[model samples]
Target: MTNREKYNQAFIETLEITADQLGDDLTYQSIEAWDSVGHMQLVSALEDAFDIMMDTDDIIDLSSYPLGIEILKKYDVEFS
Candidate 1:
């Protein structure tokens, strides 16, 4: 699968959310399933899916979907 597809799938699986439910507005604290545990799961999932380990700064900055994409891009992950 593509990077976007993998990211979307990881989000869905880790957060137990639907594709339609993912967006900038759907932040970590905004969703029921996006708690601390889910946040770590998402980080792990994204790392595994993209084969890139994230730094603490990136992890802290990944507070939203858009931020996650940006963070992945910093690791040389092409979204398209």
Candidate 2:
């Protein structure tokens, strides 16, 4: 899968959400499934999928779907 596909998959599996549900509005604490536990799950999924570890600051800053894409880009995980 491409980076975009893997990114979507992480959110899908971690949030127990559908691909259609992902968007800029999808954020941490914005939904029942995106609690602290779910956030870590998503982080783990992304790390594993991208083969890169994220810094604590990056993890905390990744508060939204759009922001997550930005954070990953810092690690060279291009979306397109």
Candidate 3:
């Protein structure tokens, strides 16, 4: 899968959400499944998918879907 696919997959599988549900509006606690536990699940998924360890601040700052893309960029996980 591509980087974008992997990224989306991480969110999808971690949060038990559909593809269409993903967007800028998707943020932490925005859905019933995206609680603190889900957030860590997502972070773990992203780290495993990208093979990079996100810093503590980065994890805390990953409050939204769009921002997650930007945060991953800091680790050189390009989308395009």
Best by TM-score: 3
The model with the greater lDDT, 2 or 3, is 3
Structural similarity to truth (TM-score) of each candidate: 0.95, 0.96, 0.98
What is the Cα-based lDDT of residue 66 in candidate 1? 82
Residue 37 CA error for candidate 1 (Å)?
Answer: 1.0
Highest-lDDT candidate: 3
Model 3: pairs clashing at backbone N, Cα or C within 3 Å: none
lDDT rank order: 3, 2, 1
Compared to the true structure, candidate 1 yields what TM-score? 0.95
Candidate 3 regions exceeding 4 Å error are none
Full-model lDDT for every candidate: 0.89, 0.93, 0.97
Q: What is the full ranking by TM-score, best candidate first? A: 3, 2, 1
List candidate 1 segments past 4 Å from native: none
Prediction 2 TM-score vs. true: 0.96
> Global CA lDDT of candidate 3, please?
0.97
Error of 2 at 75 (Å): 0.4
